[model samples]
Target: MKFLGALDDVSLGRTQRCNRRLTDPNRLQAIRDTGLMDTPREEAFDRLAHLAAELLHVPLTIISLVDANKQFFKADFGLPSPFSETRELPIDASLCRYTLEGESIISSNALADPFLKFHPSTGPWGIVAIIVLPLINPEGHVLGTFCCIEPKVREWTAQELKVMRELTASIMTEINLRNQITKLKTEQNLRDTFVAALTHDLRTPLTASKLSLQLLGRRHPDMPSVQTSVARVNQSLDRAERMIQNLLDASQIQAGKHVALKLSECDLHAITVQTLEELTAVYTDRFVLKAEGTFQLMADPIGLRRIVENLASNAAKYGAPGTPIEVVLGRSGAQVTLQVKNQGNPILGEDLKNIFEPFHRSRSATESAEKGWGLGLPLVRGFAEAHGGRASVTSSAEEGTCFTITLPLDARARAQTRLELLTSDRVAPASDVSVSTRE
Candidate 1:
């Protein structure tokens, strides 16, 4: 039988080939990513360990995860004493680490083996015979081992070795399946939250608008208070309109279609000024605008207005109360840029990546004074992208959160180009012509 020659070097304090693979950064990262390190023993892994012990006819079994600092017994089946309670061992003391770069390591008698005789688990803990199968993930990184240990000397059969290998593969399969299910569950929870918030958001504005209209019906049109009620209803409807448009645009984009825009010559600076003016009745004295030059661009007025409304409204909602929501408009080369900056708790780096996704509300957003529909930023992105432009954001505690939209000076040309491309790509036979038109 082959003995572990590297163990001799380890006793004399020399780095061996197995140690090189054992401390690999990628291998360590795979173990970390599993989220199993130092966690409580789980029944699923325990059951697998039990099955391994039964199949391999061993007194102890372990589903181990090796990291740089330690080896955790994720499934500590029948392990005795300090180990059963602690479920971990220092990396150098862990026998499982040696199997990381090998298919399997079988020791007939740990106490009699030339190199393993001095190992603690064997020499002191009465665990003598041992077999270890490395658990390599689909990405080819060896995480740790599925090990079976016994107190008495025993030679592992070919069939027992095969069983250990199959069990090790099952461990990785279980990990992958568990991770996929967790991902699906998280997405499902997010969808459920989005639906719940969307319903409440849609109902609030409509209910307010209805109440305002009812008030106007009883009050005389010439009454001073009637104008205020009308403005209130308009603002409520505008909010509802933006939400609805965003939803529809999301659907269109999902259907593999661009947000069809009606592009025309419009002043971006004028749109920002007007949007702020309209919002003044709601967020009075809350907005500050700085415009240095004429920022005219060929774009959809309603789309651009929706962009301004969504961004400015978002700022008002998330910004600190009574703090100014600043708007800056300027032309850079042949494109116009609009920046809306607000002061509030900065967005977290992790949450920023998914901030513009439909139905994504950041942790800061959830904790803010205002609860939003989660459609505003996504809508802002949809319109900006559909108009041959892009939307980007930056957030920091010192400078505040700012969303910038950069749109080409002539976006109508983009729509025209897309239309031409579609027309040229769709030459079909007479029978297929009708189906083509349906697009």
Candidate 2:
């Protein structure tokens, strides 16, 4: 065992220079990209630290990363009291910084070295020796260090150094594999949600169209009633096509793709009225429309129509039977507000928090005989947000339930703002719906 007194006579200036020199911009970025700093300890990382400490006959071992100002322990074994509890130390107080300067480090007697004797861990934690190896990614960036610490003066053999290097490779492999698995699971969940929503939405319209066709086959071709059935079938087919498009948009959103808007100056009031008429044809006099102020806006006509249709349909389906659903479109100052109100069972307090989250169905929806994939409200919110607006809901026994969307009169500006927000976050938006009955 050769005693190499490395870091001897290291001055304050030299330590400062070493800290600056070890701070690699690309390497620090790579560390941040791993998303592992200060994270909760995982068994995979803890297992490697445990093995290193036991195999090397050391009292402590740590899997640590160097950040801008501090060293964070992803995992550690045999560290005492506050140091172990905090799992971090200032960079200047840590020996882990030395590993970043080279591929590996071996300090046979840290306390005997001039500069290392002043280290916080050496004096207070009684760390007499250390063997550290850098954890490097395939991109050739040093993410952090894997180290074994001793409370007594000791020397590391050539064989021990080789073993430590092998373990370092294993630690990096575990981190990379864990991140890859997490990503795959997230993508799988998104695919399952999309498929479930698509199946449920498509089934309803397809069933309606199929039934309408069967009814038409039995009707006299010359009868006026035959024309009505034909029109109903056509409407169902159109609705099915729109639903297919919505599913495609959902996929694009999940893949971090932007929703393309067909912008035009349009009468929101007129669109609401037409949507109401269509609802009446399907559900009869179950809904009432209230329009006030100038309901004109620059927006995507198709997207706006989809938003109204979804909100109204949700109200009709969930609201108490015989109670009229109310649709209100109003303009105030620079914003246009659309409200869809219905009377039904009040949403649970816990459920209200995540009501707009994608694929989140309320207790009522889950227990009811009606089957749905819980995509309508999410799509409604998506369309509203794409226009640089927002959708929200309030439900109580006294007020029933109301879903409101507030949009800018000119959505082009809103769209640009929304794009900027999306770019900054790099995450897809979520949406929700609810209804309540009077006591």
Candidate 3:
């Protein structure tokens, strides 16, 4: 509890000098790995700052992380203007950096202290007494401080010092916890990237086989046996190719990235009917279309095809044998609606919770040993959203299960607007290193 036993000369582990150690490359990397520096203040850190300020009865409290040349405020309770907007101060202006030499500091008289008497905090900033607990990680690197400042000098209370130490421990936990999460996410992204690349490479050979099968059937019109074998091979290849694309699309969208689209003026009715007909090759005469309209709109034809294929395919897997899977498409206002419903066992309430989540399959579905449908719903949802549309589902014992989608009549405008927004956010100036992270 007496971490404030000494407030003088220090050896900085390896960097030899205090200022040099403040800018140590390894410490800077550790700070970056935490990602608290230069990022927008989060409520979790802000609440900690407020709690410390209130408990310690101090006018100002900052959860500061020292960087190479400045101290960045992860959260602050009473930081004054200019500094409040900037969220950072040069290393010379940072009393927090002095704490990074590896000890907590409690300066009872800032006006008399060599370091505090020179900083603006003791001058026009009006802060006199200060208590700073160095935020050290498990690696024993002092990242920064949980600082409390007072306008008037006050006696140091053991209770207040204990509370500060405890809260700083909590702050260190949060920093390391967040850093671990970021590292895990980075690992997940790397894995997803590998899956995407593998699936993509797989499709190249699948495509060649498909084309070769097409030429084989075309050239041997008189041979029925050859044609039948060629047809079956082509079908298997098509299914394999579709599965590969599903894996690729699921991988991309799971990482919060969109599936690339080739948008154009496409016939929704035609896409739906064509996809259903192709699906009939496997599901047989089970799909029933329930609309009569031209339903044309600006969309990605291939994307539209996948939407119908995934939904109908999903319906077939879950629907009772010989039951008709219903597909309905229509337009209202400047929006288009497409629905695929099936008469099947009502989806369990628990399964409905994450039914559309990528790679998720219900327990019942898993029990059936069905394949390919694993990523269908997510692809259905992702393709729907990529076109500025939304996909949803409802299931009931009496009403059956229905999946619905709504899309803008012209996705071009919505897609363009989104692209502009994403691009504009990325155009942060080089000198403003934090702006991109803030966005």
Best TM-score goes to which candidate? 3
Which scores better on TM-score, 1 or 3? 3
> Alpha-carbon error at 300 in model 1, in Å?
0.5
Q: What C-alpha lDDT do the candidate models reach, one value each?
A: 0.77, 0.78, 0.80
TM-score for model 3?
0.70
Residue by residue across 1-439, what tens digits does model 1's lDDT show?
A: 1233445654433235567777688877777777788887788899999998887777889888888778888995788888899888888677776666665667888776756775555666677788878888878887888888888988888898888888887888999787677777677567546755776688686777777677875677677677776776676676676566577666445434566677677778888889899888778878889888788777888889989998998888888788999998888799888899999888877788888887789997898777776877888888898788999999999999999999998786677666666677762222211101111
lDDT score of residue 250 within candidate 1: 66
Each candidate's number of clashing pairs is 0, 4, 0
> CA shift at 257, candidate 1, in angstroms?
3.2
Error of 1 at 39 (Å): 50
Off by over 4 Å in 2: 1-128, 131-145, 148-229, 253-258, 417-439
lDDT of 3 by residue, 82-111 (tens): 999999988766667766668676878877
Q: What are the clashing pairs of model 1?
A: none
Clash count for candidate 2 is 4
Give all TM-scores, in the order shown.
Answer: 0.49, 0.55, 0.70
Residue pairs of candidate 3 with colliding backbone atoms: none
